[model samples]
Target: MTVLHEKLRGKDTGYWIIQCTNPLTHKRTTIRRNPKTDAKFKTKRSAQEFELQFLKSSMDLNMKFSGLFEDYCNYLEVHKSGKSLIDMKSRYNRFFVHLKNKKIVNIRESDMNLIVRDMQSNGYHSSYINTIITTMKILMNFAVKKGYINNNPIANYPKLKVAKTNDDLKFWTPEQMKQVIESIPEVYKTAPDVRQIQHIIRFGYFTGMRYGEIRALRWKDIDFNNNIININNHISKHNTERAGRKNGDYHQLVMDDDTRAVLTEIYENHKKQPEFTNDCYVFHSATRGPYFPLAATTGNKYMMKLAEANGLKHITFHGLRHSHASYLISIVGLSEAEVADRLGDTVAVTSKTYAKFFNQARVRAANKISSHKLGF
Candidate 1:
């Protein structure tokens, strides 16, 4: 292979030229650089090493810091369709604000440590610190491939050790569930708008659907004949300075009979209304569109009010999902695999996080067997 012509331009003070042929295609290519602006290389051998490094990086999946971050956000936007790019952009902006006026290549391990220390001083928990560090590592790895930096400074940073606090895994008992359902006001039951909201809560307890999935439900995804509810979508709220925007799309999940019944009832009721006959959303607000998934703060506020009114202890709406899973394992005596399948979680997750609930059920079963043996 013949080397391409090398143009030794400038005052021989900073710049150099490299000419070489493509290893596979044998095509000739030339690269020009100003060594002063780049990292220093004294000897010809050192220059050759730098040239090889550049060539390798050019062929690999690398990107400049800004470019890599933008690409990463784009990837998240496409793959995580339920999430909005604007939300990611906000997170990126918050992280970048701390890194202003600093080159991506110059970010050192001490810089990350200082950031964590500052956050800790402001009373942020270690978990939140871990999230920031993980995000930084992802961005750094992307920069490494682009040849912006030779190494990831935060790659080996120690994770914050967090101790387990109170096992606040509270769930509604069968009696409590009955009481809550029976306590629904007659006015809410009669009102078409409020009735569906109540049903949404009940369905969440019965089927363990996430808040986003419940809001995004459509009449088309339900099958009354087969008693199947296809949980392929979620509604996400994109908060802004103005009114928040709501978006929905398909996602993976699990479903059951009670969920289907609640959906069918809601669907049939909506079908009877002339204005809602062709409407696409299952749970629309008074504004003639699907209800935006409630923000975490707003949802928690309403949940607390509901708990207070019903004379129940405060629990998150997400607690309803946990309650359902707990009931399946404890009262229903379902295996971990069965519970995991119904709850749309892996068996490992079911066993690791929820296995303790099953222990109580097992003890109860053993006691019953012992009583039979003793003829009592």
Candidate 2:
């Protein structure tokens, strides 16, 4: 192996010579009278120590903020599961664009605070701000671990406070649900676009599956004998592309008789169409290759029309999932934990958000007890 040495000069005319070998080329290089020489040592032991410290600092300085961010995104793609990689990529890309010119070490708590405050001031919700902050923190932490920075600026940053809204907990009553179901046009059951929409609605109510999970459903994931639908994958739209159709990456959800019957009907209908055979999606758009899970705005518009036609108040499609959970807990008498498991929600979230429905159910139960005791 070849070694190289050179002397570097200090601002005050002081200089030190440093020696090191290039690992890749196995070539030796030495620097003499370097600016950092004044802090040098006379003994070989002291020289070795000084060289090690200088090399460590040099390596740290060589780590670029942009490089760290790229590695962080790659880490997310490889290590993070459940969320679509496309979605993660989009979010990270937006964050990177915003932070492109900023140095990782220069990012401070005040900078984050200002960015968060600006977002909030511009009418962005706390949830959205939280997601941005989360992405930023992930990258910053990665930089710290890579020796690019000594500390993570986001470590002590205040979290955005998400305000609860009635929409967040909205659910349809049984009468309202029945009205909407009855009002759906009979032709929708047969028409390709409407059929998919009908099936999506029914599945959401019966299985509490999200829009993405419902769209990603394939014939293979369904186990009719076991009455279960595996939710191992989700269909998400990011960068105008549909993703979430792969293997061993989806979750499983139980299918009740109602949901099974609806799915079976759709499947049978699809099989009759020569073009839309078993190979096609269970719920697909006629125009679009397969339904990309309608955007939130479009889905809301359809939901509003459905509600109005049924003589019911407007409710979003997600309200169907909430209604399913509410019905299970209140009318069906399922425990909170059971409701959580069926809805793919954490027990704590289920209990906190849906506990009010249980309170009402308990009151009704008490009324029944009193009426029975009053025996006229």
Candidate 3:
């Protein structure tokens, strides 16, 4: 039911106020306007028509934003990797800190724009801000599918532009990579876990496997008979637990003799352990006894300390993957498609990412052309 009240603002001024009960919240919401400036009823009949229209619009309510957000997080736990779920939980926590239990139906594009503008004003990078915005849009779409909202208000929200730079795309030269690997302190190299770190660095350089895939490698994945290594699962960095690789499919690549020998050496060392089994992690932790895969920070921290000590260029573990790509194209003379297959990437992506290396290859091929001319 809607009720209208005539209130006297002053001796001569009066305003029309309409109050309607919200079905979802069970609270009354009031709308008031000065009768002279707006709401010129014209007649009792016309005023009743306008009052009905306004009350219907005001009383409509959708699900609460906080309630829907919880539902989305619950879904993520089952369907997403633990690390990804943690990242989303963090991003959403920052978002709800600002929005604070607003109704999903009442959220507007302008509100989203304001949030983005606020992030930009605070000096956050465009890419990070864009990721937050993308997460919000994902939640809103989920709400729509659940029939909480009629449509996504910010579905087409614009993403902020970020500048591109080669620093992010940097890859180590083969000489630099060799120097860095050789520079690991000899004392650390003798330690059991440090030996595994040494193996991981070299394996990343030769194989180009992502950090997750490399850490998740097991004894069973090594096909010594076929001279190939299988990449079937990955460990999420946040919880240090196994999950399917990023591509969610099994990948296999043949190893060169040097890589095979390195794996064999590690395997032989592990076989000395009476408790070692085929299911054990290839790079087991040292301090945590045996069979536990090294924590995600182990390789990253090792590379950082080694680079600082050796005065070499600071490159993370992923840099080792990029170094492998560069080595294959520039030195090994492998074709783009072949390199892509080895790296578990599509050919188009390989070509796009290593366009400079491909161009150099083209120049090398052109140099072999003879100057002899034939009549057409």
Candidate 4:
């Protein structure tokens, strides 16, 4: 801390001078502060405090966007790091290379507008570009909290409106799911990789389990007596074992008759193998033995290949979860809250995602009420 003692308004006062070096440009910066407004100039602690606070808010004036972003990424690494951290670094470096050297305070709306227009012109999906923009907003929000900037510039920009397509509704019915499952030739089932895909897809459809949860599931998680699959952890996209789920909920899916049957079938078959262990992955990796989890991408590619070739709609592994949710809402007539609980999601998300199914449920209720005999 550099303190300057000088005459201010005919009174001798101690002032704080902050020196911030921009890491990106390697340029030296000097910022002087008068402690008269918020701090008593006599105390040394006030000058120190003034220096600290000035670094935060006026930082935007001193540091470039990339330098602040690196600091923000470091902050996130300690607080909330994930596969997304890696993705953000790559994304920003590629697209917003120009923003790297510009001071955080100078990053304006017009600069963002040009980036969006370029991305749109390049055939990038609105949803994908929206995700990129969201990361920027989150970073800018961090800057605001740290006093890097007074307000987030990107916050005011509207997300590119995504057009809804049938591609968005990429789920299958019970019959469709069954057809795709059976479409795997009986001969291919002899291969461990093919069998693993066959079973995992079926599991995803019936249980509404995320690919992460399914890959992370251990043989120990199956409670035969209680008929529940304890979804204790999620394997992140980076293939790391996250202790809790995405929503931070410890979920246990009570197995339906179909789910229980599927679980039992896998256990009965898997128990016979020498590789089987109590703590082994329920959906064990075909290539990596019982210790490692099955790869989601490999399963998706092979599963889609067989299904698409046989005139079945392509339902990727994640689509199986959606298919299950659609089934619960439409076939079983489960409430939004009930579906959300079963799927380890919030009711609001369930309602929004399966809106058409809920609308159909409303129609069914209307028909039932009109046919009722009880009247005044």
Candidate 1, TM-score vs. the true structure?
0.54
TM-score of 2: 0.54
The collision pairs in model 4 are 56-147, 57-147
- Give the lDDT of residue 209 in candidate 4: 88
Instruction: Name the TM-score of candidate 4.
Output: 0.61
lDDT of 2 at 201: 73
Backbone clashes for every candidate come to 4, 31, 0, 2
lDDT of 1 by residue, 65-125 (tens): 4555665676677776544466556756865566644656567889888878887889887
What is the per-residue lDDT of model 4 for residues 236-339, given as tens digits with 9 covering 90 to 100?
76788887776687799899998888888889988998967889889877777889986646657765776766677776778888888889888999999999
Give me the displacement of residue 370 in model 3, in angstroms: 7.1
Q: How accurate is candidate 4 locally (lDDT)?
A: 0.76
lDDT comparison, 2 vs 4, better candidate? 4
Give all candidates' CA lDDT scores: 0.64, 0.65, 0.76, 0.76
State the TM-score for model 3. 0.61
A best-first ranking of the candidates according to their lDDT comes to 4, 3, 2, 1
Q: Rate residue 283 of model 4 by lDDT.
A: 85
Worst 10 residues of 4 by lDDT: 1-10
Off by over 4 Å in 1: 1-126, 131-170, 178-192, 236-261, 275-279, 290-301, 308-313, 374-376
lDDT of 2 by residue, 235-337 (tens): 5534132444232244567777899899888778766766653346565655665323345344566678787776676778778878888889788988888
